[model samples]
Target: MVYVEVFGEDRVEKIKICGDFFLYPEDRVEYLERALIGLPFTISEEDLCAKVEEVLGDCVLIGATKSDLARVIKKAMVRA
Candidate 1:
């Protein structure tokens, strides 16, 4: 379970859960990413947390920060 960047290299990038996260159908990740795009980064941590929990309540969250995602990505990248 990890959070991944839903946005691209463009500005206003955001984070989202990376795993299956109880999302049905195979395209849910792509859908989630699209849902998060264009959202401002000005959102507070508490607000973001609440939003994430609501959107990904079924997800087994790895942690509550980008650093956690980075760590997981790093490990995956290394393993690959």
Candidate 2:
């Protein structure tokens, strides 16, 4: 597994997976980021929040708060 960080003003910081592999775009970290391109960072805070909400909707956040995010990431890393 690989790790990635997402950051923006008013956006919750996060670390995501760039799943382990040895290939082209699949292994390209930038490509993984590109998947999140067009997210509403430049829009209103509500828009950004909505975008964040949408993204996280597909994810199962293991904890209720940021303090546990890293631990969740680490657990995912080990399981991978």
Candidate 3:
């Protein structure tokens, strides 16, 4: 799951990613979370997924796909 706090229309104040998912280069998970900080709330799922992919370059993620990450992120943005 993903949790995010948005302070303005297009800014993400903070975020957290946690679940049973596995991301190679395990330490990169924190990097990904940090990358999600300040993400635009208005970003589209596709774009968000692309961003995630960019942040996770060369890493392999199992038990989830970019789409899943996008969905959880989008949900966090909307419900934050």
Candidate 4:
């Protein structure tokens, strides 16, 4: 599972991503986290998925996909 914290009103000021999933080239997750930092809180699942895919590139993920990651982000938004 992933836990995310998003801060801002009209725009995303910051984002924190934490999870127990496995991602190859582990630093890639940091890239993903950074990519999401300044995005709008209202960003759609598809857009987030695209960003994840773009950042991930050819990296291998164990037990997760871009969609799954996007879904987790969406859920975090809902809870926020």
Candidate 5:
């Protein structure tokens, strides 16, 4: 599961990501979170996925994919 909170109207003023997912080179998760901080709340899943992949680079994700993370972020936006 993942939790995301996004703020602001046009751009994401802040974002918080939390989840029960496995990521290789766990330290890179911070990079992922930071990468998402200023994105537009209207960002598409595919675009977000691409950004996540860019941030993850060569890291192997054990139990999640960039798509999965993007989906969760979209869901959170709906809830927000």
Candidate 6:
């Protein structure tokens, strides 16, 4: 799940991401969360997916794909 706090009109102030998924070099998860901060809350799924892919770099993720993660973030943003 993604837990986010927004700032201004559409920026992400803080965020927490967690679920059953596993990310190797496990610290990459924290890095991903950090990277997502200060981003626009209304960001597109494809753009978010690309950001995730970039932040994840060589790290390996199991149980979730980039698009899946992007969709989850988009859903959470809408809910927020």
Among these predicted structures, which one has the highest TM-score? 6
lDDT by candidate, in order shown: 0.46, 0.39, 0.78, 0.77, 0.77, 0.75
Ten-residue stretch with the least lDDT total in model 1: 71-80
Off by over 4 Å in 1: 1-28, 62-80
lDDT of 3 by residue, 1-80 (tens): 43444344667776777788888988987887788878778888889989888988888888887678778888878887
Q: For residues 15-51, what per-residue lDDT tens digits would candidate 5 score against the true structure? A: 7777787788888888877777767777888888898
Q: Give lDDT tens digits, candidate 6, residues 1-61.
A: 3333333456776666777777798888778777888778778888999998899888887
Winner by TM-score between candidate 6 and candidate 1: 6
Give the clashing residue pairs of candidate 3, or none: none
Model 4 global lDDT (CA atoms, 0 to 1): 0.77
Query: What clash pairs does model 6 have?
Result: none
- Measure candidate 1: CA RMSD: 7.4
Off by over 4 Å in 3: 1-10
Candidate 4 per-residue lDDT, tens place, 1-80, comes to: 76777666645566677778788899988787777777776888888888888999999987777788888877666666
Backbone clash count for every predicted candidate, in the order shown: 0, 0, 0, 0, 0, 0
Model 2: per-residue Cα lDDT at residue 11: 35
lDDT of 1 by residue, 14-39 (tens): 54546533444435445545555655
Deviation in Å, model 6, residue 48 alpha carbon: 0.5
Model 6 compared with the native: what TM-score?
0.83
lDDT of 2 at 54: 49
